[model samples]
Target: MKYPKIRELKEAIVSLLTPAYTSKFPAEPHVPFEKFRGKPSVDDENCVGCETCANVCPSHAITFTDDKEKGIRTIIRDYGKCIFCGQCEEHCITKKGVILSDKIYDMAVFDRSKSIEYQEKELLICQSCNAIITTREHLHFMHRKLGPKAFSSILNLNILNQKLRLAEGQDVSVEIKDGLKRKDMFNIICPNCLRVILVKYLSKGV
Candidate 1:
């Protein structure tokens, strides 16, 4: 067999004399090195469930399911499928929604389900056609980002109705009259329904 070069032999000797070059994970708690990108830690309070992470995840570790009937958006984050590329954290719209927890590097688990997590956000379904507008939190995030300009769109005002109960006693039920009327424009409506209303009004020229 060919012998190791002088430099290689010297390196082997030095490595042998040195303590373990790796962390004693099982025996001792793992101490991740600086700038270590580990498992993603979600902040529910900050996560708007906008599907940004799910869209950017290269490995499809994050996924979302919308239930229009229930008006809920479910987000599933499977750490078992995560490559820990830190894309979720890097592209988070809220900037603090998903963060890489350097301390949570060890994700070894027998049950894959144990490594999966779920989050739910209230979805804003269009009252006219039952179409999904977006998550309420995502709309709120948009409002914060757009500031005063967001009020230009009646859709943005949906949040006020939720908090102020502006139409609590009004008979603005979305029973889908012959066609969507102007009265339903203020309600949480999809762009398609709103377009119909706008066109109907502009056509009348009254």
Candidate 2:
């Protein structure tokens, strides 16, 4: 049989003497590289409980629960189901609310509950229907972004007129208008109630 090449024999000997490439995890820490997409984390101080993260999560790792009686909304994030895709960070309206860190990979736990995180915020109830509309923080943020015009659409004509007058430092009595109207303004009314109101207005042909 032909003898192995001298280079091959030398390489084999060197490999045997060299240290193993496998990491000694748990015994020694491992530092991930830059831009590594590891476990997701959130800044509760910056989070407004908008549910945007839950909506964008592809793996269903994020879920939201609303307590209508208590007017509370809870957002839960299960790390056990997270794929570390960073979609939550990408869609977070408040950039500091959610982010993917490079160093939080050691998320092993004996109990599934240990791997879950949650945050809760108070919800805003509709004034007329008493339905859970959204978080108070979300409403405030939208109002700040959209200005006083925010409530002009959903509020009835009387309410809208009063709101406008109050905002403009004027006083006026509420006068109800019995006609359909459309104006480009924002409102806190939930989609369902808005739909019903819209249908009623349209049927009146005004």
TM-score of each: 0.88, 0.69
lDDT of 2 by residue, 50-83 (tens): 9999999999999999997777999999999999
All models, RMSD in angstroms: 2.9, 6.9
* Predicted structure 2: lDDT: 0.73
User: Looking at candidate 1, what is the lDDT of residue 126?
Assistant: 79
Which portions of model 1 show Cα errors greater than 4 Å? 1-17, 171-175
Return the lDDT, model 2, position 122: 82
Which pairs of residues collide in model 1?
none
Once superposed on the true structure, which residue ranges of model 2 sit more than 4 Å away at CA?
A: 1-12, 147-206
CA lDDT, every model vs. true structure: 0.86, 0.73
